[model samples]
Target: MQIAIRADSSKIIGTGHIMRCMTLAHALKNEGYFVTFYSRAHEGNLNNWLANQGMDVRIIPAGSNSIDQYSTAHGSWLGATQAEDIQATLNIINTVPDLWIVDHYGLDHVWHKAMATRSQVMVIDDLADRRYDACLLLDQNLGRKESDYAQLTNAKILAGVDYTLLRPEFIEQRQKASIRQGIKNIVISMGGVDLQNVSGIAFRTLLNSHLHELESITVVLGHANPHRADMQLLASQATHIQVEVVQGVSNMAEYFARADLCIGAAGATSWERCAVGLPTVLVQLAANQQIAAQQLTKVGAALSLDIGQLESHLEPVVKELANNSDKLMGMSRLAFSLIDAEGTTRVVKEIKSLFA
Candidate 1:
């Protein structure tokens, strides 16, 4: 069977959608199914990266006009109107796929319905705010339930963290992961784009906190992060605390295993941190992240800090976690209990059943 994945990554759209799609695509490909990606050429887009990964990639040209005309809240992130996007996608695809996976917030039921004529539709979504026209719908947020999408669609729903599309590396890392004891090592990952440079703020907050036991702080930056140079320069100037800036990391699970604590954006990485039992201080980088951050904090799996509160609240929170070993151990235990590292397998089994 052939699969077509519709997802995008840009300065505004971020890379979480496409990254998770890649995880699913790889699983399908490994199971002897052909997979192709359909993405637009937005600024900081990962079209080329997807192509380099040995999958067939089809690129849609970004529109020349302003993005204000589209109606969806995130319509501007699509770089074109829904009609135009559908037309462009139709023009490029030579054959109808057995399954079309849609993973863009800017697109909803309207686009899905139009493409349904060509193939069966599957949607991978985080926000349950819109309706969908799909045979399968997957939302991997922590507290999500099928009732959340009751009014939206009748698609077979895969809700909650059990369906999170994590890479195979996380499973391997989980085997090596042990309970964290102290806050000697820290990791700051603010997502792939980090347009606002939150990693720098977190790094600066740690440096000024003057935690004498800190041996090293590792800051992970993506290939598309605009502030990579600025972060590298800042890391170079640090005298007291050793800060390492790593970009385009393929082995993030290793970093999670080595770190005692993580300061990260509350997006898809929330599940990754939980898989490795890494206690985190989550910052809500986008409005979509608000729910996950709140739920994680509520469940005692992690801590939360608003982006606006990072400067004021981050240092104090880190200090408290550093001084209390019991809290750190408790957080790790709770986090480890949430994920089983078999999400990809479970999702793939369902997709294969569609053919059986």
Candidate 2:
């Protein structure tokens, strides 16, 4: 089988979608499938990273006006323009693609509907803001609903945390990790793209709080972070907290494995935390994150905190949680029950069944 993925990774786009797709591509390759990626030549693009993984990458040059328009619409660093990307795909695929997987937030029904003509398309999305015209739709958020996309035409829904395509390593070590009461080892992973310098704000809050139970503070940043130097500099000067800023960690399972608790944005990492049974204090870094933040909290896997309320509310909450080890342990156990680390394997198995 030949699978073509339409995904992008850049400083602004944050590499989450591309990273997840790479996980899928690796699984498919192991099952004897050929995979290729079509991406734009954006600055900080992960074409090299994809190529390093042994996948062929096709880079399309962005049209001048289209790039400007898309950047203005999304943000300047959103990898590539949707119009230029779609046109580039048409020029390459003369025959119908066996399968086309798209992972982009800016792309809406218009883009997916147009691409549906050339292949059986599967869309990976977190936001249900737009309709899709694809054979399969995957949203790996904690409490995604199938009915959220009822307006779409003939799309098979694969919604919820179970469909989260995490790597096999995370699943393998899920059970061995202890979900017990202990001093809080906090993890701060804002997003691959922490545009607002949230880590600094969070760190400040932690510092202002007079709690002493913070055993460790691990901050995970992407190598592509624009503020990497600044974050590193800040970590160096931190006095009260034992801070470590790690960039481009391949083994996230280990970090999540070691943490007694996490303070992270509500995104793809939420599912990874759930898989490892880590009690997490979820924060919505963006407007799109609110739904998942609430859903995960409602499901008893996480505690949701809005970014708007951080200054006034976060310090107190963290200080209180640190003293309540029993509550933290219960949250971890509930999180473990919410997701199995074997989610990627199950998702791949379903894809194979679709092929059959």
Candidate 3:
């Protein structure tokens, strides 16, 4: 099968989209499928990384962002004009693909509709916020239900963390790390690129909380984070905290093994944390993450906190979890149940079955 993916990674959008698609691409490759990528050449684009992975990438010039108009219209932190997006996508679809996979929040039905006519389009979305013109839709967050995409036209829904197509490394390490109890070893990973420097905010918040004095507090920042310097200073001030500012951590299993708890954004890491049985405090960083964060919270696996409410609720949360050991363990077990490491294999089998 010839598969092409529409995903981009940059300072603005972060690297999660390309990273997750790479996982799926690798799985498909191993199963004898030819995979290609269509990415925008934005600042910090993942063309180099994708090339390193031995996949053919077609790069398009970065789309124009109407900053003032976007902010005024939607109060959006990340917004692109529909015309620019449509043109970019049209340029990509000019070369037909057998299966087109799109993973972008800025795109909606307009792009989907145009691409769907040319290929069997599959959408990778965590947010059911927009209508999609897709044949198959994948939302690999905990507690995602098919009903969430009821409004989508002609969509085959693959919902929940059960379908999370994680990289092989995560699956390999899942069984190696037994759950650690009575330890306050926590991991703080915002994302590959935190545009607003939310990690610094989360770090400062941790310093003020009583949990700062816990046994071990490890801060994991990606190389692209703009606030690494500020985080370094914050880590210096907090003596109890052990901050590790790493770029590309090949041994992510080690971090997951060490973390008793994780405070992370509700993106790809949500499923990774669930797979490794790391209890999490989910913070919604973008509009797309809001539903996934709440859904995970409702499933008893994660504690959801709106970015705005973190200041007021964080103190009580820290005190409660630090004091109550049993409750923390329960949440950890709940998370462990949500994802199996073999999710990639399951998704692949389902896709192949569609052809059969």
Clashes of each: 0, 0, 0
Q: Runs in model 2 with CA error above 4 Å?
A: 65-83, 92-96, 239-241
List, residue by residue over 1-356, the lDDT tens digit for candidate 3. 77888887778678888888988999999999888898878787779878977988988775555543423222131245655655675676545777888887766676778766767888898767777888788888766789989976568899877788888888777887665465467778888887877777766787777764476667787646777778777877876555565556766667876788777898788888888888888888876677778878888777977777777786677667777778878887887787778888988887786668
lDDT (CA) per prediction: 0.90, 0.76, 0.76
lDDT of 1 by residue, 25-135 (tens): 999999999999999999999889878878789998886534535366787888778888988999999889999999998898989999998688999988888889999
Better of 1 and 2 by lDDT: 1
TM-score for each predicted model, relative to the true structure: 0.97, 0.89, 0.86
Q: Best-fitting candidate, measured by TM-score?
A: 1
Candidate 1 has an lDDT of 0.90
Error of 2 at 104 (Å): 1.7
- Per-residue CA lDDT of model 2 for 50-104, tens digit only, reads 7887888877665443453423334343334656667777787645568888887
Report the C-alpha displacement of residue 294, candidate 2, in angstroms: 0.9
Clashing pairs in 1: none
- Global Cα RMSD, each model: 1.3, 2.9, 3.4
How high is the lDDT of residue 135 in model 3? Answer: 79
What's the best-to-worst order under TM-score? 1, 2, 3
